[model samples]
Target: MDARKVEKITALLISAMIVCLSFSGEWDWQTVGIYAGSNMPERLLYPFFHTNMFHALLNSWCLLSIIFIYDIGIGRLLSAYMIAVTVPVDTLGYFTTMDSPTVGLSGLVFALFGSISFEVLRKRYYQLWMLFYLVAGFLFPGINAVLHLWCYVLGLIMALLNKPVKIMHHER
Candidate 1:
């Protein structure tokens, strides 16, 4: 499948997949997201699934925004990246002081932000400084820094490795 098609449907498909999860009474991140106790299959579901409506919507919005603004380069890579993006984050979360189930699309969203920064800004200090403003959430309790950082790093890697499609500015 093409990456463009995947990008277009990603938000809807993932959002729909978790709607029934909300009604399934298994909304706990422990059951649906990645944690130390999570099996391999559950870990596979971590990046794409959400435990609540708000979380799902927030991620869907992020995904949609990236689809519209970013080139996404290759659609198939988007699918692979979406799934692989969470691995290191989850692994770090599981190993590094995450005593409870940590769940949210924030990591994935952050990854998108990171990829956009790396691919578009390309180490331009002026633009990269904007990333500092995103620090507020990092200080919040129950938020794992390792997971977010790792996801971001992976996103950067993918964006750089996959031939970044830097959307050129075209003034109307």
Candidate 2:
């Protein structure tokens, strides 16, 4: 599918998840990944729900921007997020903490940020000065800097494999 179509579908899906998560408190455990005994599917669910509207919006904006800017397909976006952020978090959280639940889409957003940042730097696109915004997460003290850093590194790996080559024409 095209990037626009993928973006629209993503927006709709995220909106629905946000509404469902907001109204259903009991379902929080279902959407958010907990440090419980092995439940493999929970890894894939981490990106769909958030702690609050602000958290959802933060992730949604990052998601949309990455999709639109790089024209990343839905499958690529979903696969990268699940593999880069969700799976590792789920596996590690289980062994590390057995009670606290990790809830938020920040990991996915960090991956996106990392992908774009890596592509920009690797290509030496200095005119893309907007990369300075990468530190935007610094404003939010609650962010998982460690998790984000790991996911970002994974995103860079993904970018290297995918190679952002579709947009052959750079803006002059």
Candidate 3:
């Protein structure tokens, strides 16, 4: 199978999974998202769910865009995705005492943004745009700006520690 084909399939499957999960429940993030009293499973699982269809679609779009734009292989993308999901759950989720629980894939989206920024697009303008977006994110109600920042920093560190390897297609 061609590597590009596999990458596209993987991204599509992931995006579909996220959207499907969002539809599986009528409960909002407040009901299932990670809160201070949330169990371990909730912490780990909350990133996969979203509050609504619009949120799900936006996240899915970002996820697909990042994967396609950066040409990230499944292994690398999965690694960063896991890190984005788990690190915050175990770290900040342990210490934060917010009234609301955290949910959605924005953290992973920002992580991918950070990874692409550091490894592939080092342009100052791109980074400035991300910075502006990050700042603007704080102004929106119900946004987890802290989680986004943490994931972005984590993504940057992951890029520094292990740079992304572009996948090459070979037909046999």
Runs with alpha carbons beyond 4 Å of true place in candidate 1: 1-6, 23-28, 73-96, 118-130, 163-172
Q: Write the per-residue lDDT of candidate 2 for residues 1-108, one digit (tens) a residue.
A: 866786768756775676567555555565465344536566666666666677677666766666666756676667666754444554555334335456667677
What's the lDDT for all of these models?
0.62, 0.60, 0.77
Clashes per candidate (backbone, < 3 Å) = 1, 0, 0
Over 1-172, each residue of candidate 3 has an lDDT whose tens digit, in order, gives 9987898888899789989988887776656687656676776778788888899999999988877777788777777678655754446755444567787888878887777776554579888888998888777877877788888888777777776577999999
User: What's the CA error at residue 40 for candidate 1, in Å?
Assistant: 1.1
Ranking the candidates on TM-score from highest down gives 3, 1, 2
- After superposing candidate 2, which stretches have Cα over 4 Å from the reference? 1-3, 26-31, 36-38, 84-86, 90-99, 118-141, 164-172
Model 3 residue runs over 4 Å out of place are 28-31, 88-97, 163-172
Number of the top candidate by lDDT?
3
Residue 55 accuracy (lDDT) in model 1: 66
Better of 2 and 3 by lDDT: 3
RMSD of each: 6.3, 6.2, 6.4
Query: What TM-score against the true fold does each predicted structure earn?
Result: 0.68, 0.66, 0.81
Worst ten-residue run, lDDT, model 2?
Answer: 126-135
